[model samples]
Target: MTMKESERGDGGPGNGRPDTGADERPAEPAGLRGLAALLRPRVSRGQLAGGVLCLLLGFAVVAQVESTGRDTTFATARQDELVGILSDLGQRSERLRGDLRELEETRAELERDAEGETALEEARERAATYGLLAGTVPAEGPGIEMVVGDPGGGVKAINLLDALEELRDAGAEVVQVNNVRAGVDTYFLDGPGGILADGEPLTAPYRFLAIGDPHTMTTALNIPGGLVKTLQGAGASVLINPRAKVTVGAIRSP
Candidate 1:
């Protein structure tokens, strides 16, 4: 009734026991072993270096993208502000230009007014000078005063005319005889009583007021054979006085 050993599965040769003959198999070659180790996945110095470089490159690319995005956002946000600033500056510049133009125009207008005033003042001065020289205006300055009295009635109208000519030749700017203006158009005539100037009879002790250099007028009349000598030669008494101030108050009749 007992089973044979072949029927006992636990003691059989191909049963669940490791094969002892595996150790007796031939050893693999050194080159094959090295090649198999290389083919196997493992961490080495060269592989580690390559993996680190790849990680750094990925991180740099991500950072570059993020930075570029941030810059673009900031630029877009400031675009309106920049445009407004430029617009305001342009407007201010235009206003300044306008103000400058107005100021320049004002300056030019002032210059024109000043020039006109200067021209007007010059014309007034010229008119005043002409009026003074023409005996139309009353003049007062340092000059000579002469008194000629013809007591004997021998003094004629020609003697008065010669005295006027001498006074004019001595640079007399203005002359008045017996309160009458002795201008270029003045005339001397022989009246019934005495000499007449401008048709007005002049009384004795005829006064001659001349506006000029006192020394020049005095020297001119006192020269030998001059107006003073000629008047004295006649019955008229001549007296020349050099005065500090003499006024020719007679104005020419209009």
Candidate 2:
């Protein structure tokens, strides 16, 4: 073969085939070689571990700095705005506390007023009952009727007063003599023509109406040595009648 054919039979530099040589071997990939160099154990195990810890500490310091920077943004905000927010919260809390206290006071006051009203009502009821018993008010119930006929005008004021005492002792709630109210403080005086009770003149044949239990009043008057016997000894005709219902429609002057 000629020299040109011999050169052609050998692969040219531009050909896809690799050059063969006894001193050359296949080259490793660049990325794989770099990875192998990094993984190669060149230091002690303790030294490697210390290097990784330092790297993690650096990353943590960087994160802390970023977080502190964000917090400083709020700290550098307007002083007036921060003060106003805190003041508003404090005032709202105080107002709520004041409202709660006022409600409690109102409830306590209402309870006290209710108790006072009940006590006042009870006192009024007691006053009314006493007024009725004292002959200051008109009364009506079963009682005894007495007719005293003093034909000789011999019924003295003392005798009338004694009879009133006897009737009161017999549970007489109210008494009327000749349509005149005989109260606890009533006075009887001897007049020229007849007897005067509470400044009102009374004629003869005095009619006494008392409000009480009829049986009790009758038994009290009919007892031996009672006011009836005394009045008969004074030459006054006395008659007592038990009535199922008797009314003393006279009220003492206020």
Candidate 3:
């Protein structure tokens, strides 16, 4: 009731009974307090945005590294291996060029051979034609043969000459009379007992071998007033035979 009692009474709220109201309030659990402190925001919007940007940049850097690895084929290859590959490619290119050169040479040779063969063939054809025309070689072709029988000695040199002229006009290339070759300058005359053809004596049954178109020669001789009719009128029997192949073996001396 003295000064100490007065001091206790002067303390506020329930005379300071060790503040029981505050102690009576429930104390928060340690785990709940720690959870609430972690949920409380410590960073601003700007700092959060900066953190997101840095994470994205790290991911981009990792993606770039992977892409570089995929794009370069020989990125991990050794220098010696690369050099060997280049050498192999050079060898292959050289082989291809060699094959192309060989093919070109073969084509040129074939062309030259074709030209030479053609020229040789033409020369052979010319030789054959010249030989036939010059009467320097034996010739055979489709033609006609005439056998004249003069029983009454009425077939003279003039009759033989007329027959020869008609044959030449009818496309006769080569002509022979009684095994005597008839050239471009042949003549006929009346001999002692027969007719003379190209200065060679020819008796009755004068055989004429003419090389030409058989049908044309036969038609020319057997016309209405042709050489066959004239020879028949002179009391001479003429027999003509068309031959598939007529050989004129008689040749003029060169």
- Strongest candidate by TM-score: 1
Candidate 1: list runs displaced more than 4 Å.
1-79
Off by over 4 Å in 2: 1-117
lDDT of 1 by residue, 1-254 (tens): 35554465664476656555656777799999999999998889999999999999999999999989988764666878878878999999999999999999999999999999999999999998888876788889999899999888888889889989999999888899997998788889998777899898988788899989999999999999889889888978998899999988889865
TM-score of each: 0.65, 0.53, 0.62
lDDT of 3 at 119: 95
Please provide the root mean square deviation of candidate 1 (C-alpha atoms, Å).
Answer: 12.7
- Tell me how far the alpha carbon of residue 236 in candidate 3 is from the true structure, in angstroms, after superposition: 2.1
lDDT of 2 by residue, 21-128 (tens): 788978999999999999997999999999999999999999999999998874877999889878999999999999999999999999999999999999998887
> Which 10-residue window in model 1 sums to the lowest lDDT?
1-10
lDDT of each: 0.88, 0.87, 0.89
Q: Over all chains combined, what TM-score does candidate 3 have?
A: 0.62
Q: Point out the higher-scoring one by lDDT: 1 or 3.
A: 3
Worst 10 residues of 3 by lDDT: 14-23
